[model samples]
Target: MTKKSETGSTKSETKSKSEIRNWAPINEIANDVRAGKITALSNVEKSIGLIEKHSEFDAIISVLDEPAKKRAKQIDARVNNGEKAGRLAGVPFIAKDNFLVFGGETTAASNILKGFEAPYQATVINKLEAEGAICIAKANLDAFAHGSSTENSDFFVTKNPIDKTRVPGGSSGGSAAATALSLAPFSLGTDTGGSIRQPASFCNVVGFKPTYGLVSRSGVVAMASSLDVIGPITKSTEDAALIMDVIAGKDKLDMTMIDRDILAYTKFNNNLTGVKIGVEKEYMDEKVDKEVKQIISVAIEKLKNAGALVAEVSLPSSKLGLPAYYIISLAELSSNLSRYDGQRFGYSYPDAKNLDESYMLSRDIGFGDEAKRRIMIGTYVLSSGYYDAYYKKAQIVRTKIINESREAFSKFDFLIGPTTPTAAFKIGEKSQDPLQMYLSDLLTVSANLDGGPAISIPAGFAGSLPVGLHIMAPQGEDRKLLGIANGFEELSK
Candidate 1:
């Protein structure tokens, strides 16, 4: 069934949302479409052509060709009839594989869910559609979103858009690559730990993780209930802000969602004058690559010259964030993955004669190696006797990190660091070393632990690979974080 468009606005009915034409990517296409300068069908056609053109990148899993074309036609009809369209009218975007979106299977890149079609749409997807954004494709991700690289995807690893030899950062790797490849103006991604920001860093795009509970999580697959944040992978900060303005409001479907700020996120203050930024000293330690360090330092120096007060600050508990995140997220992952037994909507083992055998066989045959690894680890930590030793201790570490983050924010408006310790590594380089792979998120997981907002903007490259300048702000300060990020776009890149 075709998903319905939520609005039929005329030219005069369209609100003066923002002067989106000034933004080069997402809104430019939307403005032109509403003004009748270009048909929605024409943009959809171009986007389809690009998807086919870059099929080898493995960035996208399923293309919603028929439904997207149908929706585009509908938008063009409304525009032709002089009816108003929404803010993102006629714009196309991609969603990460795990989101429960219509038009294709919501597989999460794992065989266990290979044939799962969404019975309902994710809140973010619905919100975007209501604003007239069309989802043209589903992007690949680590199966069950269990790894730091798309290599964990049961089907195939997504290649970095800029350099096919390297891996796009996971588990939002495919979404990041799709945006960078220009398959769409923006794409949706989930950040638990650093899935969204790490990939965006590697692919030279912008990734924004809202303060926890700022965006509703309804209909999106849960990796870790407390940690998951739905966000956009976009070409620019302004475009991200525009998308957030539509999707950031509270939803009764998600009890955790908070009320969005009344001030429009689109009206961001990009002026950096007098902004106090804390450079994360821990992030610039010996383990960080010299070249990557240089890139981050250059960005800090640039900000300092722009009248921003910058100083080195420490969040030492952040050093333990990675280990804490793994224990917490995996425990939640194991619990969440429990519902995917053979009796449900996805793949089920046909040969099993007994109920217990069916459950054992289905999961054994269905989950990928990384998925199984996480499941075992998650279960191990949450087991009878080990719960206090592992899970409880991790939560203690998480709390310490949160307190440190709060203290850091009391003195500084935002924290700056390298999104990743290094630029994108070769596709197979860290695959065998789970420890190394887990380390990719060392710098980003702190924000999630703190339950605050964070973003990754393209910084200079480390050789051929693109790196991002990671920034963070305290809880409930998402709007200010977004504004500060918008200010550094030109200087960082």
Candidate 2:
């Protein structure tokens, strides 16, 4: 059934499953592309082919076919001409739909923003493309990155690659699922309250959330501005580290942007000897599933055996993480979502009697339930009457959580815990109960609340489901955190 081409190579030979899978790491692929061993066009096609093959997973929102192919050809030309190819030459990756990307409508999985095109690419996308990484598609996410499950998306819910019947953790579920399925070697996701790490945990990949402002958030869709931090979901810590090296830096566009570490992120020190790690009591509470607790405990024991100094640590304010995060996030979200008021870009009311009616109807019809709920709660908290009692108090609690985390770091190098209370839950399991849905972030929100770096890595499994070992370090210690996670990844093996 195979036909030989003019070059005497069968068409199928060019489409080998391994080539389509892109199993090589970033460095290997980049080196090969630069050396002309593999054409950039072929790399792009491989990623696109794999994405099409796994279309049923609902992981992608839109594919940048023409753009990606065009970029690939340009990169191929550069390498063919003996030019200096960038570090990520010919690598194809995915970005969460929430990100503002060129060549596709950055819907953010919400009807309000449906069909809206980005005026320009996100800073992260710009940086990646500068190094020859092509974003082949925009992955799905919860509507406006609002929910714990992709079930809240205005589009179809993204299926968990491991268990289609189950939910992929959200609002970065699509990115995680895509990364898990190898639709791309890696993908980008924004974490405001475990959006990145939770899904990464569920899908059994490495998800890293850098310290706040470490990566420029310019051009990304606004979520809770204070809490939002974008990171990667990839197969290994090394890949994430290599990516961090490229994307981690200050940008004039984002006022909050900070300078990156002087040391290259790719230089990971795997030695855990004498490293002090604290096991948070609250994160490993009795409420955590027995299987998950055991798996996490075993992972911790691996660290101890590898010469890490392990000890019990408590942060009572950790209990306030969830509540504080929700309040501040919602308040910020309310202010951010206010931009979609029918007049600007995105969906506007087609039938409206007047401006006021247009504003009301557009938002009412455009936003999903979860988005509306957050907007309402945020508005309520920021309202004059409740601002002092709710928003102000929440900010105070946030400071306390940050202080407690800093205090812990003063004594310990990193704090560890289970990324979630349980593994991937069945779709619609907790969607009906907001409280239960919120509980899913119980263990992962403090890092965001305090602007500390955090990462989730695979820790064996709880039954058949993957459990993530959540790791946290003090603010601005993202490089060290990546090093620690990489060490654990090696130690666990």
Candidate 3:
């Protein structure tokens, strides 16, 4: 089908309104809003409609209807007054519940934070709002962002939009599910391991994980201080780039963020001539689903045909990447979570007999099994007797993984792989086996362990489920990674 373009010309508008309403490109929506073809209020209304229409997915924790309506009116008023409303003008978006946004609670999908309202907004949310974007909802995730599937969420399990019976990958599952269902053009998600990319793969959206510290983490509920990175989940790589422009920068509050060149990610050229790409051997383990592997193989062929050189490389240290990631992440999680002792903030037990009982009762009643498991694991690893054997050793292995990744980057511009070993599995399929659940992040944890950037783009389908081609680059090379991903995305189309 052909639709009228902004230039009064006809262009292939293959996706129907029903198909694209929730997942439309950022530029397309922004252009229409600027041209007065659509009002910000109408866009927000449509997003609200979709959120209600797909309520069964359990992808959202809360909707900001009142605030969203007010914000849209303000944007429309600005547009009518002949004032500029910033780049993202009227786009509607959702932030993972972990982000501290006004109009709703920031629970991180955990019960311990049941009624904790954020005093201020997260840095990323403020940046996006500055660009005229409206956040209309808060998406669900695993409690404290601990699990690989939304099943670990204290509230509800976020069902996959593609197949409702299957799990939407997590701990960022709700963000990916919302994007897939077109509830928003783009959604903010945090990736500590494969949290963003794995879910994007399952939902067939563009999930971007910037180099550690590229986006400020201030006001976000900390999971793993070192591994936690803020990023976006969008319908297209271009949308991801557009979002990166607004959110990728250093903030005084987050001193870990580094100053770097600002990239006009939307103006990328899709030429891969003479570019060298590496297929990480560790990520292609025999455990990967056969159908998913085949889809990735075809994607590599497309890149090769685009004038890129492909080679097989070994990152042997990556085999230990998962263990190291879990250890480090849990250790950080334990320390970060200690502040939630029920007395200061978050959920508190009213029937507690004493102060110690209050702390024990609140945490015991609030934390889900998964959260408890992780907290226990984290405490054990950080304990005096096991610190050297577990936590310290994991850190050493993490360093080795980073060094090995750097060595590979010297030979190739980026590393490519399947984002997840398999497509979305049936809900509760792996919930009983924590080891099996952890394996879902096998191919993705190395990038986090190395503190590098990675992206997941839709490669193709594995039967009815979608597979993602994972592309990763060295730390601070996010622009290069996105440019290459844009080329691959264009090629896939």
Give the worst 10-residue stretch by lDDT in candidate 1: 12-21
Residue-level lDDT tens digits of model 1 in 394-475? 9999888888888888999999989999988998999998888998888999888888999999876666566799999988
The digit string of per-residue lDDT tens for model 3 on 325-357 reads: 899998999889888899988989999999999
Runs off by more than 4 Å, candidate 2: 1-22
Where's the lowest-lDDT run of ten residues in candidate 2?
Answer: 1-10
Residue-level lDDT for 117 in candidate 2: 90
> Would you list the C-alpha lDDT of every candidate in the order shown?
0.87, 0.89, 0.88
Candidate 1 Cα errors over 4 Å, as ranges: 1-24
Worst 10 residues of 3 by lDDT: 1-10
The TM-scores, one per candidate, come to 0.94, 0.95, 0.95
Instruction: Give candidate 2's error at residue 211 in angstroms.
Output: 0.7
Arranged by lDDT with the best first, the candidates are 2, 3, 1
Q: Cα lDDT for residue 74, model 1?
A: 93
TM-score comparison, 1 vs 2, better candidate: 2
